[model samples]
Target: MNRSYEIMFIVRPDVEEADLDKLIEGLTGNIVSGGGEVKAAEKMGRRRLAYTVRKFNDGFYVLLHVLAEGGLITEIERRLRVQEQVIKFITVRMDEEEKRLAKVKALRDSKVKRSALPAVEAVAEAPAAAEPAAAV
Candidate 1:
């Protein structure tokens, strides 16, 4: 049976872009060998992490949407765990019901115009100050 997954991983901030591409190439090759088809792949770039991890404040993020056999996800995750460059990783299963809903959501999101977003001031009231600042 075919199944879908959303896999996300954070690589160490020190990795060069060329090495990162090589790593991605190796991983995708493994997935394809294991009978998986990559749907959407994205590099979300480096961003500040909520908290420090291994003394690093940022990580390079990558996300892959794939369709593959159910058992392949476990194999892929195991490989990731053994890789030193990967700081964190996760693979989430997407069932048929969720897939359908995701398709609908994607379609809806694509149709919305960025300029059509409502003005922030018109949407809510300003908050009052809770306490006055003390003089130095």
Candidate 2:
């Protein structure tokens, strides 16, 4: 079954920008060739690492959102493991998170709509009530 996933990876900071772009393209190419569809790809740029990794104090961060079969994820991870430029990488399945977020958003939207209607009705009634008080 196809599932939603988020992949975050840190590349060695010394890599050139052009090389970084090529690396990202190659990784995404692997996903596409494996029958996965990439939803979003973000390059978060160079950032300081929480701790040293492979003696590097900083790294380039990239995040990718994808939908793919379980097997494809394994393949992608395997490729990352063998890549020399990738200092660290992680993948998270987002199906449950997505469902929960959707539920929360829907509930919030409904509450907002309900709250808005009463405010407008109350404002409309206020002017009418003031007119009667003035006549009295």
Candidate 3:
């Protein structure tokens, strides 16, 4: 079965733009060749990292949205680990998160919309009702 995944990787900061493009193309090609669908491939550009990785302070960020089987994903990760330019990488399954969000949305939609008017009227009537009771 196919599942959605987000793959984010950080490449070495000193790598040239052209080389980065080629690397991304090659990886995407691998995905397609492996029978996985690339939903989105985004070069998020270079940015500073929170902490130093492989003794580098920053690197190019790449995010890929993919739909594929688990075996294909593991193979992709293995490829990334072997690649020289990739400094750090992580893959997350998005299907569970998507399902959770959808469930929350449906629950929110099904909830009863409570109005404040009735409660306000009850509070307002309480004082008048108490005054009459005291008089009686």
Candidate 4:
């Protein structure tokens, strides 16, 4: 089954911009060729790493949101592992997170709708109540 995923990877800081673009294009191409869809690809730019990786202090960060089958992820990870410029990488399945957020949103919307109903009823009743008071 296809599932949502978030991938965050750090590339070596010294890599040229052109090379970085090529790398990203290649990775995205791989996903597409593998029958996966890339929902979003974001270049977070160079950032200081909390701890040095492979003797480097800073790295280029990239984030990708994708929907793909489980096997496709393994293929993508394998490619990342083989790339010399990739300093670090991680992938997380976002299906559960998406579901949780959707549930919370629905609950919030229902609460808002419920709260509005009482206020509307009160407003409707107020005009009728004031009519009798004004007549008296």
Instruction: Point to the candidate with the largest TM-score.
Output: 4
lDDT of residue 36 for candidate 4: 99
Clashes of each: 0, 0, 0, 0
**Stretches of candidate 1 above 4 Å error?**
96-136
TM-score of each: 0.71, 0.84, 0.79, 0.88
Question: What's the ranking of the predictions by TM-score, best on top?
Answer: 4, 2, 3, 1
RMSD of 2: 7.6
lDDT for position 64 in model 3: 98
Q: Report every candidate's CA lDDT.
A: 0.80, 0.90, 0.89, 0.91
Name the lDDT value of residue 24 in candidate 1.
Answer: 87
| Candidate structures ordered by lDDT, highest first | 4, 2, 3, 1
Model 2 per-residue lDDT tens digits across residues 16-101: 99999999899899999989999999999999999999999999999999999999999999999999999999999999999999
lDDT of 3 at 87: 96
User: Model 1 reaches what TM-score against the true structure?
Assistant: 0.71
Clash list (residue pairs), candidate 4: none
- List clashing residue pairs in candidate 3: none
Model 2 scores worst on lDDT over the 10 consecutive residues at 127-136
Candidate 4 on 32-128: residue-level lDDT in tens?
9999999999999999999989999999999999999999999999999999999999999999999999998887666556555655668875555
lDDT of 3 by residue, 1-136 (tens): 9999999999999999999999999999999999999999999999999999999999999999999999999999999999999999999999999999999777554432222334466777555545543453
Best by lDDT: 4
